[model samples]
Target: MATEAPQRSQLSLRPLERDGFTARVLRSLTAFIQTADLKPGDRLPTERTLAAQLGVSRSTIREALQTWQAMGVVQIRKGSGTYLARDVRATSLHVPVTINLERQAVLDSLELRRAIETDAARLAARRGRSEDVERMRVALEEMEAAYAEHGFAIRQDRAFHEAMFTASRNPLYLQIFQQVINRISDAFNESRENPFVTEPYADESQPDHRRLYEAVACRDEAGAVAAVTRIIDFVESTLRHDE
Candidate 1:
């Protein structure tokens, strides 16, 4: 009897629910963009088809597309349906190779080159056509001429690698490899102690270059891998010694 009965309060806890419709629709559209490798001017599926695929209403899909269009991520065509915007960004190209000069970065990049390019060169040798072989030969010739005349053969070097990648017959690989090499070449040139204007690469580099070219010309896969690896290793060693 000392205290009045305590008042009892009832509390109800409800589990949190996430919005499903918009998020799912957006994710579905994003995945389609990536999987199709859709470039600018590529048309997306009709609203009906997209809605069916996403298991949502057409309104929801339309809403998502509208949001993307507002963000300049996609474009809507009059009576022509929706198309990807002109500014779709490819991640690899835009990514910056910073100047942290991390030891791991160099090692990793080299490792990637060795893993992919060794096989690329091997393929170039085994399957390359006469035109490809001739192209490589021309590149080497130009490189030699540059050596003798100017000591630097920037264009020639790029041409040789481009020919090798073309020989691989894999377009995706060729595109990415070319980009990587281009960046590396820029860095390598910048890091050189003596420009082509001053000191040319040692004569030994010519023979190694010739060896690689011949391997592709002759369709000698193993020889091509060996030649490429040897040439790259030599360059790396020389650079390290200079450093």
Candidate 2:
């Protein structure tokens, strides 16, 4: 006698509360995919269906789907529907840690950066090659040029620091920098919008980047550490004053 196939489980999503709704939605969707035994190329439910199931607005569902799409977890086809871009059975939905523009959180993030980056600066000075130094120079020059034209050099600034991390020649340092700094960078950007500030913080911080690059180029480990320390201290002082 032929046996019947096992029944597939239903997609059951709990109503998400207000706090961390996006995160909850991601978790719920992950659970639904697992329970439903979804595979790559499988189409997800309609926004309306997912919204109703999760007790959220269709916009919220769309936003979650868009985020997943960006992460390569899902693929959204215009006029068709969202489909799984990859098999999520062995994958966990990762929610990036968001740092609020709150005072303590900003300070804590800066402190953590200072601790890691000071050591990274020293390591870069010691281990960095000529090419690594050139990368820092290019990023710094681009940052200065962008700041001169736009009064903000967010991308170039990040690239400069990323170059520094790369120059450190430590994969772990680069990894940690990406994970921690990238997550909290939005908060730092938002903090610059404070109406009370006399000058653009980026302007004040520009020289520090150049100094850091110079130190690393010359292989002055102590100077590199000092430059990194000064940069963090200045940022901390500015934020503290704002508070």
Per residue, candidate 1 scores C-alpha lDDT tens digits across 1-243 of 595533212211122223566545555556556655667888888888776656667887787676567445678987999998854444423222222234345545566667778889988988899988888888888888987887667678767877888888865556556545544555555553422223435465677789999899888898999998987786566555555
C-alpha TM-score for every candidate? 0.57, 0.63
Error of 1 at 240 (Å): 1.9
lDDT of 2: 0.79
Looking at model 1, report the run of 10 residues with the lowest lDDT sum.
7-16
Instruction: Tell me the tens digit of each residue's lDDT in model 2 across 120-216.
Output: 9999999999999999999999988988887777778779998999999886666556646655564555664542233377778888889999999
lDDT of residue 111 for candidate 1: 62
Q: Stretches of candidate 1 above 4 Å error?
A: 1-104, 188-202
Output the TM-score of candidate 1.
0.57
User: What TM-score does structure 2 among the candidates reach?
Assistant: 0.63
**Candidate 1 deviation (Cα RMSD):** 16.0
